[model samples]
Target: MGKATGFLEFDRLSEQNIPPHERVKNYKEFVLHLTDEEAKVQGARCMDCGIPFCNNGCPVNNIIPDWNDLVYRQNWEEAIKVLHSTNNFPEFTGRICPAPCEAACTLNINSDAVGIKSIEHAIIDKAWELGLVKPQVADKKTGKKIAIVGSGPAGLAAAQQLARAGHDVDLMEKNDRIGGLLRYGIPDFKMEKSHIDRRMEQMAAEGVNFLTNHNVGENIHPDDLIKDYDAVILSGGAEWPRDLPVPGRELDGVHFAMDFLPSQNKVVAGDKLSEQILATDKHVVVIGGGDTGSDCVGTSNRHGAKSVTQFELMPQPPEKENKSMVWPYWPLKLRTSSSHEEGCDRDWSVATKELIGDNGVVKELVASRVEWKDGKMAEIPNSEFRIKADLVLLAMGFVSPQQSILEKFGVDKDARGNVKADTEGKKAYFTSRDKVFAAGDMRRGQSLVVWAIREGRQCAHAVDEYLMGSTSLPR
Candidate 1:
């Protein structure tokens, strides 16, 4: 350990964010990474605990303590090396991921956890600035080609790993751009698109062929990929959003979170949409209290909405979790995102009953208070209320992967509607269809970007082993 007693000496310090008023004016990143000294101090807060639960807490199982010690010692190059050893894109995870690692920190039991995410942000940004991040071109070619569908975190990670393992990887995306959700689903205010573009450049230099606007199930038949490529990997994320099938669901103003979010992102990326959904001068109601809903709030604020309100069906969680009961694990606590800090009327335990509309456009939302009793939701009597809502965005998470792609490939589905695949044994990641594999949300359903990256890396190892009869890539 770089500093044995440093945890006791230093308090946790986090990165600063731009004021909501100032940041909401433009669709640009506002969260500033910690400075070198601040990051070093934060890193020093990492305890010399024998068992590092932070590693287990992190979806990618990053070597947290190693990098923490390196950052504390001001070893910038080594810090990034340790970071990249597990996470393919620290820039992505550092910016958007809710740090489960911090929750599992030994210091968190009694005190503020180390600012691990901020330190990671600093390390990766410094690495890029110092030219430490570069193409890892393979010395030898395996002559094996893999077609990876979907260019999200999962696809990107898998492509990067397989390419480094000397395989020709064709990373395909149905969208007009490279990054699937990262390019569209995520607002630029949280994580700018330049980070994804930078990695795309690095990946191209590393011999990954990027094919954009390539819809395999539609334009390109699924059989072609299996026939032409040595292996086919389905890294496509879960795109089927959960819908609220209440009255007036057919209203023109009601839209899925994906339908509403992508257009704003496209506009931010300098694309012109003839009929893009905007919250300008309208009363916006965003249903669901997850990250997607928060994103809607941010984007609505940016769109100059007359008012923005967020609704969560579940009861509100405690502002602070009981650390004694949930220590070393992700605790249920109220999380206020930067978007929520901007401006939003947030309510919990409210369920929408109907979307009242004038003509074909939504005008108001009728909802009622709810209470949980015996694990069942029970509506309170005579608690119904109506609120003005010119637009409604449903962000109640995703239910399953798009069945079209799965059907096209003829892969077996689990009970949850995701591609049926195991993470262990010889058939790890292998789908029902021969030479076809599934990973990320396609296999495991809706999850974090870090989890997607982890699944992608492991799936790459599985595919590499299947092809070469052995694999050096870490799972």
Candidate 2:
């Protein structure tokens, strides 16, 4: 610990944000990172707790206390070194990850947890400004070729690690751009696409080939990759969105959150789409109470929607958790995102009964209050209600990856339809098919970006070992 009594002397300092009224007018990041001194104070709050559960709490197992001590000592270069040693994309995690590490912090048992995410953001931004982030080009080539499908966090991490291990890596994306989900699934208002572009540039300098518009199952056959490359890794996301199967779901104005979100991201990137699903001057209803739903709220507000309302099928969680019972683990609690803070009418324990439409466009939503007992749901008697809705966005999360891709590769699938692959033991990340591997959402179903990165790094380590009969890459 940098300062033994620093936790007692300092109070938590939160990052600032642009006022909702002002930020809603445009699609750009509004949350401001902490200043150097503010970050220093926040970092100093890390206690001498003997054990750092935050490391285990993070999906990528970030060395939180070490970086906190470095930041407190103003060792900016070393802070990023420690950060990058574990996380390949701190900028992404620092901006959008839910920060489970904070929930597991020892200080969180009674006091506020240290702002580890904010410190990470500061360190990465400082590292970039100081030209400390650069390509780690390999000195010798391994004379092996590998193909990684999907350019999401997992694929990106795997490609970079394999490239650095002296292998020829081709990172492929089905879309016209890289960053499978990060390119479109996320809103630019939360994180600009420039961060992804910058990392791609660094990766290109490291000798990882970028192949866009390369749909494996559609245009590029699995046989070609199996024949041309020494090994193939599937890292695509869980793209099969869960649908609301009620009547009138065929209405024109109703769409999946993914279909609506990507259009805006493409427009922001200067791509001209002939038609966009806009929320302007319309009564918008977003179904589901997750990050995707919150993103819809934010984008609707930016589109100048007449009114925005969100619905959740589950009951609302408590505003605070009983830390004694849930210490060192993630707890279920009420979470209000920045988008919710901007402007949104949120309701829980409500289920949609049907969608009322006119002229093939959605016009109203019929829903009812429900109660849960013994993990079963029952609608309340005579609690049906109707709400005006011109546009309905379903953000209820994804169910699994596209089965077509897995079928084309002839790889075994789990019961949940994700590519069947283990994370430990001798056959780690290896699919039933010869020389084929899977990681991230493609193997583990839908999950956080940090977890995806962790799987990618571990999968790369496994692949390198399989190819060379041994590996020096970190797991």
| RMSD per model, one decimal | 0.7, 0.6
lDDT of 1 by residue, 1-475 (tens): 8888999898888788889889999998998898889988888888989999999999999999999999989999899999999999999999999999999998898899888888899999999999999999999999999999999999999999999999999999999999988999999998899999999999999999999999999999999999999999999989999999999999989999999999998998899889999999999999999999999999999999999999999999999999999999999999998898899999999999999889899999999999999889999999999999999999999999999989999999999899999999999999999999999999999999999999999999999999999999999
Name the TM-score of candidate 2: 0.99
Error of 2 at 364 (Å): 0.4
Best-performing candidate as measured by lDDT = 2
Q: What is the TM-score of each candidate against the true structure?
A: 0.99, 0.99
Global local distance difference test of model 2: 0.96
Off by over 4 Å in 2: none
Candidate 1 pairs with clashing backbones: none
- Model 2 superposed RMSD (Cα): 0.6
Q: For each candidate, what is the lDDT?
A: 0.95, 0.96
Tens digits of per-residue lDDT for model 2 on 335-355? 999999999999999999999
Task: Name the 10 consecutive residues with the lowest summed lDDT in model 1.
Answer: 11-20
